[model samples]
Target: MGRSKLDVGEIYMAESKIDARIYSEEEYLALDSDLDVKYEYFDGRVIAMAGAARKHVSITGQAVTALNNQLRDTPCEAGSSDLRVQLEGTRNYLYPDVVVWCEESRWADKADNTLLTPLVLIEVLSASTGHRDGSYKLEIYKQISGLMDYLIVSQNRVYIE
Candidate 1:
């Protein structure tokens, strides 16, 4: 789909063009630390986050809960999508739906909200970010040396990768 031209002071619409402001890694982190909404940074551009549907929220909970139950006996721990994972290679700040780690869980900063060493990452797809999630994010996540699995969960039906 072609992107529509963005107007100044206009509300953001999914799939439509916006300010497209590019942010440095440090600047993005500052925003992430204080901002209520999570913005994904890639190649210097900030992607505005969209709200998830109720069904999407439910599926995400189920996926995380199941992963936690399965890993209860092991040292590996499961975290919901709230955790921010920085791609070790590209340095893009990303939030996965479920992050499971058996390795060291280090703090990203003094704030300690971000998890830097997640071994297994899961993403619950939404309509607006499906393309980027499947293509852009998938390629970056695959490069993480410690990441064992990258699961892409579809909200429309029972599907995962």
Candidate 2:
């Protein structure tokens, strides 16, 4: 399949749905590994992620920093957006802005890039992602047995849910 790469700092307004072709979990993972941009797998479709604005990046960084400080000397560790989280028992994989896990970390495979259990998942909302982050992704994330908190933070203002 033909694909276009977004340049750095280019803002993709919405989830770019891949062509009608359905991809298996393995296929998605294999394709994702070779790409520069990140994509989230939903069922059999892949949704291309949007570029983060300055505020989004700042909020995500601050959240991770704060979590790291509070989790120091503890069992928990914080992860940035580069971490891929797999929703167990499903083919879905998402990249939350920040993830914190208190338990022994679990990876989907030897690759170690895909995290299996995260206690806290944080999403720094942007204008393009606020709706999907709050609704569609929320329902899917709820299936994680070890998830204790799901935070939605607004980059436009001081708000969190």
Could you say which candidate leads in TM-score?
A: 2
TM-score of every candidate relative to the true structure: 0.80, 0.86
lDDT of 2 by residue, 19-135 (tens): 456789888998778558888887767777767888788888989999999999998889888889998888788999999986587888897888898999999888777767886
**Candidate 2: residue 13 Cα off by (Å):** 14
* Top model number, lDDT: 2
Off by over 4 Å in 2: 1-16
TM-score of 1: 0.80
lDDT against the true structure, per candidate, is 0.70, 0.79
Which stretches of candidate 1 lie above 4 Å from their native place? 1-18
CA displacement after TM-score superposition, residue 36 of candidate 2 (Å):
1.4
lDDT of 1 by residue, 5-84 (tens): 23211222244343377678888877766567777666566665667789878888887888889988888778777778
